[model samples]
Target: MAKSQKLLTLCIAGVALMSTTSGPTTAFANDLPANLDQASKSANQLKWVRYTDPAEGAFSMDIPVGWQIQGGMFRFGYFDVRWMMDARSLDAKTIVRIFDVNVPPYTLPTRYTGRQGQPYSRPQQFQMMVSRYLDGQSYAELYAKHRFSDSCKIMKPRTSDWVPTLPASWKDDPGGRGTQGSVSFDCDTSDGPRVATVFVRTTVYPNGLWFAAPISILSTPDRVTLAHDMVQHMIDTWEKNARWEQYQNEMTKIGLDRIQAGFQQFMQQMQAYHRERSAAMNQQVARFESQQSNQAQQVSRWGETLTGLQDVSDPMTGTQFQVFSGPKANYYVNGNGVKVNSDVSPGAGFHQLTP
Candidate 1:
């Protein structure tokens, strides 16, 4: 199989694992101490720093002071599908990953089939598709069936119901409406069976744009409860930067404008092509008419045909010129034969000039 196909398969499998839902084991819920609510509240007392992306200024998240942050692109084929932010503690035991998913025009799929092997017909089908992919297995059963790594042996899978309670700071934030869930398990490492917990929160937008954050922590059995608490605390502090949202809206508008402009250009090209062909036919008719008509009449008809050809040729030439003018600007001619400039800045917004 191709590399891209392999990566895609793994991604699908990960999503399937995340969507799994089965009855929690009785022991799984009882293993952890009963003071989880208090622990989560206490975790908020820890010192944290908000880390924001320096390049696009797209997002920001709060993490404990000692955690290290890293950013990367998740690519499929030659296109980037998502931006990944990873924060790991100094001990490398706890890790949180936030995936910002977006598909640009170049990479957006023309059609998508659900897990049921059929095209979706309704918005609710998405939830059904996820449930179908998971196959009704509990978190523990899913992990046991699929190991985390080549050397890792997942065992003693446990699960508990986790509901995220956002802090007062996020009460009015749109992002706070994200759906959250969690699962816990144990994996055999070099030391032994180490406890691990995973927390996932997904936010789906009305436009079908969705992003998920899956935070996983590997720790000693004794620290499992603390790991769970910290995950909740982190979620409570999650915030979407307002400037980033504004930038995204601007980008969307620019994208739509480019699409509309390109379509208009295509229609203009088709009309010009037809006019050129018609002008050629009219010139042929004029040449035949010249053989049987007076010189003045033939010249007049020929001049009209030539003028029509010139009108068609001018726009075609302008279109070709725009094609070679580089990526700095998108050029289009107005009805008055004047050129308009639509310049776009990278990761910024669009600037349009009057014709």
Candidate 2:
């Protein structure tokens, strides 16, 4: 890319970062005449404007005018970021957030040895993700408890409906996808009782890590519907900036080359440093090896767990195996090393496995 183009891209990104974090959203949300709290009565009057991330300009979303908006793509560590934002009514009754920062990575402590097995604890981080399955509703309920107050009560609506939106492609992802879940809650806050409905979406990968995000709308019980509509509108209209993505990709490549060069130099220095620490480092390898073997045993199980699979045991041979969990077929095994799923018996000596 030309130097001028690079400079222009940075300038645009700079503008976005300022706008989102500085909360110029309240100023740009100018198209609507009615306030967000009042617009709840007649959603048709609501107007929206594009809110772009100043950090990378990677994404943009249409948000209702007049809402007090802040937050944007935040860096997590080297080469990773959680793109998100928070928007709310001037009255502070309605809020819409894209991602939860406090959620932990899907990886379990058991997956790692030594200090890596511990949960991430900085001096204090109020929110985080967990190893829980995310089919949407269950996660939504969990999210409610964490994002809201602990004592918050989930109210199961009589309708028996819990539909949330998800992409069919999520299932095809290497990390299996989860169905969206929605749940409403009556939460008690310092101000008073408020009703909140949260929707969660997630996808789990083979490494026991999952990408998940939540969309929530909260308000007084009387205003919940309005908040819901506003949140839904944003979800439906959210868009990504392809140009910004290209710029990021270009920058990433440039940065990666620089990092690789620096890393090579660092490694050379580290080799000498490690020789001095080798005597001490050797002692820890044995402990890690023991844990590594245990981790090996759980590899398939953990993969199944993250991918929504399960283990089955064949009574005839007293052998066990893992397969996708579903009611579609019976899993069987013969003298083979493992089992396979079939509609009927594969042959004699092939016993159906018990789930």
Candidate 3:
């Protein structure tokens, strides 16, 4: 159960961290009205551009003018990023991000005690999941590591109804039940103290699969209200492309199949390599043992040869003598003289003899 909780936290952290990077997306609609008067009519009335991802067609979103859009891949699938203005210190920046959520294969214990030791109700369980996700340990570590903030305080999330625009075919989908909520908080950051408001919309399918879109806005205290209003406007204009979603599902299946096949092939190669390495190691050990045996025999033969030599005394001269045989020569030592006789070659010395 603890492992499952950690996995859930990690998956959520991955999603949140991935959101910080930009993703793949297209430009605004070409047919948008170019007139300045029409663009300024209202925040919602601004000229909006529609972006469609070309790879899996998994994501589509409409971005307002003066904002930048970037798209990229995530573990679950693809994500889309849209942001307005540079987030310089003392300046306000609004960033909106959308990504899919995939719960790993496991069941979270529905009934768990909270930090207060009180058992959480079903609704509270869901809320706790969201709370823990937004204030993930990874997120906090990132802020600290980069000196982005001194600390963070996640406010209690407020739950509300959130309906996502899906295709007609998806209306009766099993996990079609949807919910929306937002969490607001303040942090002391290196760039200056800033307030962040995050909005999340989640749809849980009948099969237990779920998808989430979390939009975050960061700004100075004075501009937080304006940033909040901008976030609402962006949400109001948001729409999803059903065709892209279908394309994404098909492409994802194909990609997974390829990955599985590649992994199987790699494992086979690794096993064959291991077998060859083991055989080689065994052969080397055999050679080493044979060499050691030969060395021991050589030492035994030398010992026997040395043992055969005896000390001898000549009575007439009272001279003590011993003879030793080496691989190339024999040596005779006594009180009178030291003599060396070579079986193969002889050198001139005090007492040298040739074969």
Candidate 4:
């Protein structure tokens, strides 16, 4: 349970903290003026442009010139970027996703701190918010290109109503050639002898992974193959990408697990080191305390020795007595130090005189 929790947290944190950007989208027909319905319809034909870049570590097919790509900008880690593109004023669109083989640090620690008056003000805080919303989450987009003499249209049908009419051999492919799932749709109109429509279905994975499946339908059977082939190629590319992504994710999981184990081992080693250091310090302190105690005992013994030296002994009498002197010691009757002369030695006399 603990391991599971840790894994979940790590994955969620990674997704939540990924970087992403948003740009303006081509205005849909609903937002246009009521009086210019025909002009609005024609203008809507230009919905997507060509996107040449790869996404999620996958490459993209060539996009014809005169088209611009738009929508769904995704940034994973520090260098991975992914997005979908719609040709402007046309019913055709391309989706581009990229992932860097090698990535640097996603962001600095200071970026998340929400510091006051800093260059990256609230960066961390913003990242936290985005992560909270997007962690462990996935998303996808349905895109298309429509070439109209004067107009184009993009549609997003609700999930319950979406069912694709696929080609004959769609089921035979290893990828979900005929399989249907919860999908999003895109439709485009082109400028030709008559009206034509191209349909797209997009399936998204919650982990910020997605696949685009397109089914082309035209008024005549002759144009059907071209439409089918175009979408078939896109689907093939998406399938390749999905498989590659799966492989990458598997490898990433294995690598992260190894790293976590290493970190745990390092932590264990550090804890043991700290314990050993603490014990050594305690032993040193004990030794110092013992030395101080011994020194104190020696000082007490020296004080006792000084007290004993203050007592004076009378050699002749073999008695010990306290010695006292007033002002300065005076010479006795002789020059010898402390001489007892015959003149002062009449009888055994003791005097406490100020000499």
- Candidate that scores best on TM-score: 2
Better of 3 and 4 by TM-score: 3
- The superposed Cα distance between candidate 2 and the true structure at residue 109, in angstroms, equals 3.4
In order of appearance, the predictions have TM-scores of 0.46, 0.57, 0.40, 0.32
Best by lDDT: 2
Error of 3 at 208 (Å): 18
Candidate 2 worst ten-residue window by lDDT: 14-23
Model 1, 201-261: lDDT tens per residue? Answer: 5444322333344445666666566666766665566555577556544543444456456
lDDT tens digits, residue span 246-298, model 2 = 76556545545565667789999999899878966787787799889889878
lDDT string for model 3 (214-270, tens) is 545565566555445444554454444566446444443454455456778999999
RMSD (Cα, Å) of model 1: 25.2
Q: Cα deviation of 355 in candidate 2 (Å)? A: 85
Compared with the true structure, the alpha-carbon lDDT of candidate 1 equals 0.44
Ranking by TM-score: 2, 1, 3, 4
Which candidate would rank higher by TM-score, 2 or 4? Answer: 2
Runs in model 1 lying further than 4 Å from the true structure: 1-45, 72-84, 99-147, 166-181, 201-213, 269-355
